[model samples]
Target: QCTVQLGGSDQWGNITAGTDLVRRVAGGKAFGVVSPLLTNASGTKFGKTEVGNVWLDPELTSPFAFYQFWMNTDDRDVIGFLKCFSLLSQHEIGELEEATRVEPEKRIAQKVLADEVTDRVHGETGLAAARKATQALFGGDISGLNASEISEVFGDVPSSELEKSRLGGDGLQLVELLAESGVASSKGDARRAIEGGGIYLNGERIQDVSQALSIEDAIEGRYLLLRKGKRAYHLVAVCE
Candidate 1:
C-alpha cells in the first residue's frame, strides 16, 4: 500500500524495475526516492577508513570505535552527515551549521553527529561507555576505566608485549621502550618524537624523555599505552 519506494542511488534501476512491474501487474502508480550515495567532500565513498569499513555490528566495530568514527568526520562532511545520518530537525541542523562556521574548533557538529548516530546504533548504555572511554583516552584520565574498557579503546591500535622484569623496580627507559615497542623506528626516532613533544604515555604527554615507565604506570597493572601523535596509538602489555 506504499506509494513510494526508497533506495540508494545505485539501486535506482532496480527500484524502477520494481515500480514498472507494480504498475503493470498491481495496476498502481508508484514513485521512488533515491538517496544520494554517501561520500566525503572529495567524493570518495563513505564508511571506509584506514582500518576498514565502519560496521554497525558492535562485535565488528566496538562501541568506542563506532563513536570515534563519527567524531572524526571531516569538517567538510559533517554538515551533510548530520543531514543524512542524524535525526535532528532542520532547525537544529541549521543551528549547528552556524555554530560550525563560528567555532570550527569546538566541533559541535561532529559531536552531535557522533552522539546521534552512536546512540541510534548502540543505545544509551553503549553511548555512555563510548563517551566515557573517549574522555579517558583523550584526557589522560584512565582512573575511570577498567581493564576491559582499556582494551576496547585500544583495540585498533598496534600492541606488543614486554617482560615485567625489563620494567622492574626503576622501570624501562622511555626512548628504548618506544623503539622496542615499535612506536618509533629506533632509539634516535623515539628521542626525536619525545623531544618534539609528540610522545604520550597512557594518554599523558611525556615531556621528560628521561623518565622511565614501571608497573605503576600500567593500567590495571598490566598495560601501557603509547601515542606518537594525536591519533597513532600503541599498546604495551607487561607479562610475567
Candidate 2:
C-alpha cells in the first residue's frame, strides 16, 4: 500500500500528483508528507560549498573530511541539524538541546551530529578514524598514526617531497625547509614566522629558526608535518 510519501517541501506538489495518480490507478488512498530542506542558520543550504555538493561518495569526500564538515556546524544550527540527521529519539534530542543551552562549549550536539552522520555514511571504523584524525590535528599527537592514517589526515593539506638524505646528518634547517615546503611564502617569511613563535613541527612549536628537522622527526619515519599556525598545515615526505 502506498499509504505514505515523503519528500522535500519544494516537492510537495509533485508528491501530491504522484499520490493522486497512484490512487486513480490502484483505487487506494495515499498521503504525502514533505519536510523542509536542510539549511544552515544563515539560511544557506547544506550539502554545498564553493566547489560543489557534499557528496555521499567516499571517493568524492573522505569520511574524515565529511565528519569534520558536520563537526564544524554552528551552535545555533546544531540542534536543528541533530533532529534532522540523527536517528536519536525525540527524548534524546531534547536532552541534547538542553545540554547545548547549558554548556555550548562542550559541543556535545555537534559531536553527536558528526558521529551519527559519519557512521551512517562510512560506518563505525570510518568514524573512529575520523575521530582519531581530528584529535591528531588539534591535539598535536601523531605518535599513534600509521603511514596511511597520517596520509589520510593530511590529504587536503599542502604537501611536498624532499630527498631522504637531506634529513641524514645535521638535518634540514627549519626556516629554509618551511619555505621549500610551502608552509611559508619565502625563507624570510619562514624566519619571521619562526621568530614570532608560530612555526610548529609535527605539532610541537619551533621557536628557534636554527632547529633542524632530522629523520627522527618524520611521523612513521617518512613524513614531516609543518604548521605555520594553528590551522595551516604542510606535509613533507622523505623520498629515497
Candidate 3:
C-alpha cells in the first residue's frame, strides 16, 4: 500500500476515508496530505474544471498552444506563477523579477516561466516543436512546414475540405475555390480580391482570377492555404 496520497484540500474527506479503511483492514499506516488548491490570477482553479486550462496532452492542447498560454500570463502573476510552477532557484527567480522591472516589454519573466514549465511538461522534443511552430506562425515562412504542422499552427482558423480528385484535370479555379472555402463572399468577390492584389495563395499574392489550385499547390499535397487579406486565413484541406 502506498504510504501517502497527495491531493487538493477538497479531497480531504475522500483521502482520509481511504486512509482509515487501509489502517483498519490491513493494519497499515497511511497518510493523506491535502493542500490548498492553486488558482490563477482570475481565481479559477488550475484544473479540468477551468475552461482555460493548459492541458498536458498534445492532442487536447498542442505544444504551441501550451507554450503560448504560459507566455501570455499576466505580468502581475508571473512571478508568483514561476514560484509555484517552475523549479528555478529563488535566486534565479529574483533575477527574472529584476529583468521584468528593467525590461517589461521584452517579457523576460513570462518567457522564462513559459519555457521552464513547457519544457518540464513536454520535454525537449515537444518544446522544440512548440518553438518551431511559434516561429513559423509569427514569421510567416510556412512554405516548408508539412500539412500536419500547418494544421497544428492554424487549428482555430476556418477550414474547408476538398476532394483529392478535385485538384486533378481542370483543377479548381482560384476564384471558385476561394468562394467555396468561404475566403471570399462569391466568385465575383474572389476575382475582385485577386485583382486588388489582396488574395494570396500559400502566402503569395494572387493577381490572376483564372488561377487554379491543384494537388501540387498544396503543402504535402494535402492542404492549401488561402488568404483574403493580411490576417484573414482560410485552410483548404484535401482528403481522399
RMSD values for the candidates in order, in angstroms, are: 4.7, 4.2, 3.0
> What TM-score would every model get versus the actual structure?
0.69, 0.70, 0.81
Local distance difference test scores for all models = 0.87, 0.85, 0.87
Spell out the clash pairs found in candidate 2. none
Please identify which of the two predictions, 1 or 2, would achieve the higher lDDT against the true structure.
1
**lDDT by residue for model 2 over 77-103, one digit each (tens)?**
988888878889999999999999999
Q: Which residue pairs does candidate 3 place in steric collision? A: none
Q: Per-residue lDDT of 1-240 in model 3, one digit per residue for the tens?
A: 479999999899999999999989999999999999887677778889778787898889888899999988888789999999999999999999999889898999998988998899899988888888877666666766778889989877899999999899979899998888888899999989999999878767888889987889998888888887777889888899
Better of 1 and 3 by TM-score: 3
Task: Work out how many backbone clashes candidate 3 has.
Answer: 0
Off by over 4 Å in 3: 18-29, 55-60, 89-108
lDDT of 3 at 153: 90
lDDT of 1 by residue, 186-211 (tens): 99999899999999887788988789
- Pairs with backbone N, CA or C atoms under 3 Å apart (clashes), candidate 1: none
Cα error of candidate 1 at position 185, Å: 9.0
